[model samples]
Target: MRNSTLLLAIASAMLLQAAPAVAQNNVPIRKIKAVKPTTELTLLDRVESDTHKKIYQYNEYGYITSVMEYNKEAEQWVLNTDNSYRQEYVFNAAGQCTARTAFNVDKAGNKTTEKNKAKVEVIGDTTWERYYKEYPDSTTHISEAYAYDKWGNRVEEILYGYDGYNRMEFIRSYKKREYSGPVDIYADNANYTSIERGRLLYDLTAKGQDDYHYTMNTNDLYVDEFRKVVWQTENDKLYAREYGCNRSLEITVGSIEREMWKSSEREFILNADGTRPVRETIRSYDETGEVMGDNISHSYTWDNLGRLLSNIRYKGTSSEISYKDEYTYADDYAKKLSLREAIAELSCGNQIYPEDEFLQFGRIATSSYNYVADGDKGESTYEWNANGQLIGGTWTETCTQSGPDNDNPTTVTDRGEIRVGYNADGHMAWKIDHSITESDFSKIEYIYNKEGVWTSEVEYSGDSWDGPWTKEGEWGNARARKRLATRAATTPKFIDDLTDGSHSIEKHDGVWNTYGNYNVTDGVVTGGGYQQTLISTASVPANPAYNYTDPLMPLEREEDEDAEVASEEMWYYYWNTDKGDWELDWGPTDAQRVYENDGNIVADIYDRNQTIVSTITYRLDDDGRLIEETYSKGGNITYEYLPGTNYLLESVETAADNSRNVCHYYYSKHNYVDPTGIESIKRNDASTPVWYDLQGRRITTPTSKGIYIVNGKKVMVH
Candidate 1:
């Protein structure tokens, strides 16, 4: 494991060094136009509606500096604009802006800024932590302190708050923990202490918790968490990660392993293949401590291109197995893996034994993936401007793999073509994906509001942009096309009222129905559309009255509650009837509905006699978000996002044992927005989606539910 981590650390350093560098004179500044690479042409311009200001700026070299927002207070919409946050920039010799900084701003309009400098530092990138002190009058004083660890990780931050009388109110501290390895784990803790008039107040202490983690893995991971088992190699190599928990595990159960491999400067050592190390096989290194090719044990060899040619494996009893692998690269630098050969040369005693059930009984099996490069396959290249904007590309997939058929031994050919275009503001204007059958052209168009928010998107799969294609459904004539097209760009307006239409009440049978607009504005959506009826609701346990003895109290006295029980029925009937049903049994109501003076749904009511046995109130937030919900009989559960962030902080379970357990959550930027305090969940709280620029293809996902990318091109990891 140590060897694996060391190798990965060295590899990451190399990759970082090879990344594109910003010119020394190019200090990154803010830009109003979406930043773009030099090679691509932008087709759209971003216009700000709030300020009614539009501007575009770039580095001297024409590279985009930033996509900026303007504020009325600033008076001008500049690349490096100001808001509650401060912004700064650096430009290179060609005057190309490289690095920019964003930090909280003070009332003085001053900020603490850092330059990216486009240096792409292979190591030692530092972070700055800013502290703020707010007075009772609502004014804040900004101060910053820097503390970092050996690994260039930030560790702690502190700030103070005061009251209107200039008396200290409290102190806030942010602390972090970072571990060193191929993977890094970070945890944050925040503490607040009360202060009065520049002195300590109350007990003077408050506490909070937070955590973050990152990893550099060689074995590709589908999910970020470590619970999943992606695959186990024949050599017993395994790797896994868990998304929500931000945990990962890697193990090399193999005997012989690759180590100390640094392509640059060619640093490596050769050892005889086995579990134990032997002195005779100990390879030597040169004066620079670099293991030279000459020091390689006879067991390994390399090709002229510096690729590993073959590796020898020992199987004891003077037997050996040799494996070789090779790779070929495309013009664009995409590489293909080809297995050269697997030769097992063995010398064993002449004996026959029945096949093991694990292998022959079909309980377990082996599988291999094969790749054959297509030589005659037409090759294509894509070009994007210097702004990292795509001009075009030779989008094609030619090679195919043949494997076992369980679900179905199938060969998938990438048959569709994609073309992307950008707007003048450097935002994606449209993306066209050609149909596999080559009959229709499928496309998705994005329209961004002045605020840079993507307001609407229209998808079409048709032979052409002309008539005879289904919009959402149904083919349309010219007039229909015009109407649909107009509506396609925007959502329909809400009907003001249904008063003029109809307001009728009818009761033919036992069932009575009333239909009418409930408000003058915003027509009531009813019946088939939204019946606004109850599905089910949670409720308190049957028994209600009891001594409710404190478990912490003396055991002899704890039985007093049972002695006081009026009746067995009284002990069991604790139901809150007003709320229709328990929240879990049915569902929570809209927060807006609760805020608008509607009756709060507490819980379901059950009765053999209905004598007010018991009641339970599931806690709810102002936004109608469920807080700590409890089963009054005994158990209680609470769901909430962590503080200062929208990520699911934890789901806690409280039980009769007087003990509580928690399930924590961590999230990648996708599928989640940074939320402050308790979040308001409108619909799906379990699954939130965000978008990803997967090598330039916009893939929208929470991805947890499951996503198919490129029609079997790959299954997205949750």
Candidate 2:
């Protein structure tokens, strides 16, 4: 929608230009015919009504000055609401709203007295508000200040509270630069406007830090087309930042250079597709801009949609690490099988774009191979109903093809059929069976608020691990778009992948290979979406019997003192109830994550329970930097930002065993504001919906209770 104020500003500019100049510094006033000052536009009093009447007063410049809501009470005019009924506005020389004051009234026809009205003031780009509360015997007041830049982006904020003594209560600061451009979600393209900084403070003890933010303009996100935001503090360090980025749309070579700082610079080269970085080179330099240390490079491979096929990391010129993950579609399974698995059958597709779309309310599978370590191989299967809803799947992995038997003594892990059930509103109510378990599957249940936004997720390991699963974590103050409430739970099916055409307990995980690790990543649905990765320990597991206490958890052996430490991660997903398919968001809310660790990231164990020995909770500042880290164990750490930089963490507050903690933060911004897109759903996909009456008989027009599937969604009929 077009902005009203913007339109008015354009009109005003045009009027001034169209005016005829009578003299060097004056415009013709059309031989002023005004009789008196009264003829000029002052506050125009007007009243509007719908269900209730509201009186509006506007200034000569067309700014709303006051608003009063009223109703006729017993044939007499009175305020519509006893409180919060009237508001007055004040403007600055620039015609910008400078202040706002709110007034209240009482039941006895008493209006707000001039003395007790509450007001807020905006000086330039900063906002200052003083809130006062009335009590029978005393009044309390609190003041807050927020600073903004010329672009109207908030830069800093502070709050002051009074108790026995008046003092500065709290503060937050940010560095921001914003830009405008087009963004296209369909093309999966975004161009970002970023503001960031870091500083070495004057006191060397207390630093004044500012956070930063950025947004993307997706239309051909090449070259730098953003405003530069520079912030400085009066500090003694002589700190200077040299950061810049350059790209080429004109060049035939697909490459870019980004110097985040003198000592921190990186380069990326796109693949033939020119959609994503095919190779990235990072180098650290000394003050003289000479290579100071090891140079690292990352090589990436992708499909036509820019989906990553493989990624390899190189140190200097030596290959340090390399891995390949391939994909196969459901319809292409036959061709893939004919290739004798020479090309790993794509399972749970590894392609980056719309892995869910490959399902097409059907099934997709993936297999992986590791040449470096015992050639570990593994595969996973997924099934989606006609509604594109994930219903069940299986996975199998082993260290050695012959066995985790006598010699290799590795873990042969398998998981049974995993099924999901959803509520009527389409939100996942609960999903049973683990992705890694062979049998006696565990379950995870989800709880959502009235807004259909998931609030809590609990785990139930069944009688195998723990009795019943309990709430693990919740969405902390996260915001979401409004959606319908979840409806009654229903089951969707993956008919194609079913061996017996039945989703039953008889199904077993298909063991493909013995090595390699599998990971599933997705974006979280919330404000400021962030990417989250669920990592499984490449730390291989030990062989276990069918009734194995921990299928993925290897038993600690004597020689295993320095064995690959294990860290397990379990991920529970939700499908878009309305669409009946897995939903995707911008990113995950990493702030609310709970970390329980055994200090073993190199273990073969993927157990969430029992291995955890330490637990910590983290909170991020406005700049998305870790400002606080609280542990279940006694102590915690607090962080302060560096001057000028939006994300650089500095001036740490650590418990005296303090050796001057060091922290650094990087900033990247995403536009949460949605743009124009399809407002209605397209339901033209081919689907043969089957209807069955309550008595289990096929029915077209049911006179009795029945359930039917249209497309992939189920509809209740009676």
Candidate 3:
């Protein structure tokens, strides 16, 4: 996703190139045209109706120097006074942008006030940038300097900020690199060094605080081997530390040779043929550095053709089996078969394929059993079209119980079937799932534009397969393809109005029943009402408020009554270049109380006048996973993750009462494959070597002097 503002600027540049030379003094000036809504099957179209026109001035070097936006009111073009609507730029002799200033303009197109300015200077291998913003009484400035290596890698950076009267250094970061090995095996010259370590220090006293001032230090270490990072460690002063290791080994199991790789927190034993891992194990540890309860492992069975046949999971040192799954595939087909026939055959314990010779080696059924339970099992049957698309399927679960009081075993079953339809473009058009046990059904239908791009999706539910259906929800008009842009739904209310004497409802036996009502006084619900029966009545001291000493809160907190009924919410999106997607650009809204900073919802705001609701503060790891969350109302939750993986090893939640709840999560994988490739330059073979480009395209003869692969080795061509 591209920034809409930057796209507008680029569009202005294009218009300037096509503009006629009719301006005074032959200056290059062009009007910014209204960008039409892109009809290229984009999920969400811009609301172009509110688009305003702007004029851009270009220098002789074809660089944009100034931009002024206008508003058409009363059939006249008036200069927009908004600071963001006008900008000026300065360029150096090399056509490099040196300074950018944004200011407010008067009706006469004269700059009235300087809002903000940024200037940059570059010398040899170093660069400096300064930013200034004007407030009512004082102007604050921030300065940053960077030093880069010859290979264009940043080696050091420093930041300073003005503290009203004096400038103070705030942060310093340094990078360490070593040139012992090639940085890129595919490049013409791979002599550059790689970053091996880094350190960052923060001056806590930069903001003029002495009592709470202590420099914070962060260190990172990266160990590279075989052109890949094999070990990494991070330490945050005396706060926390973590390390990760990745390695591979060759071992023999019985008479078969196998490859093994420790991936993150799990160890995988690959198959002898190097196709996939036949076994995996995950072990966890406690806070005291002792091994926790049991180690989870998964073993897989595959056929000669590399097809999975069965997978079994085990736990603990005793090797207690947990669950087992078996798969069956069709080997040959004589003719095409109907979906009903295929499902029926698989359900009857037959793995026959279609008779029309449509598909071969297609998985037909899978059965899973829980070994912990005497008679708990599930089975799924699938029917696929010639296009290899799943068209129909059935899922069934069966449970059997027998006790001393009962001589015969009783069996219960729940079954469901799903059917899918695809459009001519091979996109899913509709799908329906019918629950045989409950005699209910739900369906989703997709709508596409003339260009065959999916535009809308609607879900409906019905009591039976033949009755009238009720619309549950609809999502459509996504600006980013396949991402939900808007959703509208009319859902049933679970709780009554929050006014005095309001009660909550619970669904029981397909009917909603109202519970006891609650007492409300002064817009705050009292504790000794119906809520007491549902929750504890104990009261704890209010949680500590969020630290506002840093002046980092970008939005003001407001107090309002919590709505118990369904309400609509609107979200604004901004382009995230790192994620290559649109992310919510959040602010204070009636529907949202959380504020985001650096891609994290760091704080929750509550109205001071209303009841003191819990405000949550989050702490994240380097990978942006939540590690700890503290609530101002009395409890905190901490998560222990498997090193270098998103999988959680354990989580502890402490309530306001100081009572703690601990949970452990176990993970297992079957048929995992380790990446295989040569990470170093290899000697070329004697035979005529094959040449290929970086994109893996074979080259008949070298016509250009560049990097190419010869005999599986990358080499520079002269």
Candidate whose TM-score is highest: 3
Query: lDDT tens string, model 1, 209-230?
Result: 1111111121211222111112
In candidate 2, stretches whose alpha carbon ends up further than 4 angstroms from where it belongs are 1-99, 103-266, 282-296, 313-317, 330-364, 367-376, 400-416, 435-438, 463-718
Per-candidate TM vs. native? Answer: 0.24, 0.34, 0.40
Model 1 TM-score? Answer: 0.24
Give candidate 3's error at residue 178 in angstroms. Answer: 20
In model 1, what is the error at residue 561, expressed in angstroms?
A: 52
Q: lDDT tens string, model 3, 1-718? A: 1111223322332222221111111211111111211221111101111234445432222223344555557877666655223345565665455666656667776566776666666676544444556644545444444343444433343344334433333323222222222222212111111112211111011121232222222121111221111222223111112222222322112111122222224445556544445666656544345556677777877666555567788765356777887777754323243322322222232212111121322444444555554668888777877766668888888888777986689988999998877787776777788989978899877766445545456677877655376555211112222322232223112223446664543222111111333344554444321110111111121111111111111111111111154432323334343653334454223222343445445443323222224455666667666676676767776667656555445556677788765544333211111223323332332133345455433445566666655544456655
The lDDT of model 3 is 0.42
lDDT of model 2 at position 186: 16
Please write out the lDDT profile of model 2 over residues 1-718, one tens digit for every residue: 1111212322221122211110112211111111112222222122222223334332222222234555556766666543223334454554444444444545542346331323345576544433343333334333334343444333433333333233222222112232221111111111111111111111000112222111111121233321232222222111122333332222111122232225454455544433355556666665456886787766656544334456566656567554444454343222112111111122222121222334321244543544444555566676766665667666666554554454545555554566777887765677776544545656777655435545445565554433354222211112111111232234321111212221211111111011211122232211111122333211221111111111110111112111254332222333354654433443322312233333311221122322434434445545445455544433454555444433223323244244333322222211112123312222332123333222222233434433433222344543
lDDT of 3 at 383: 82
For each candidate, C-alpha RMSD in Å? 29.4, 28.6, 24.6
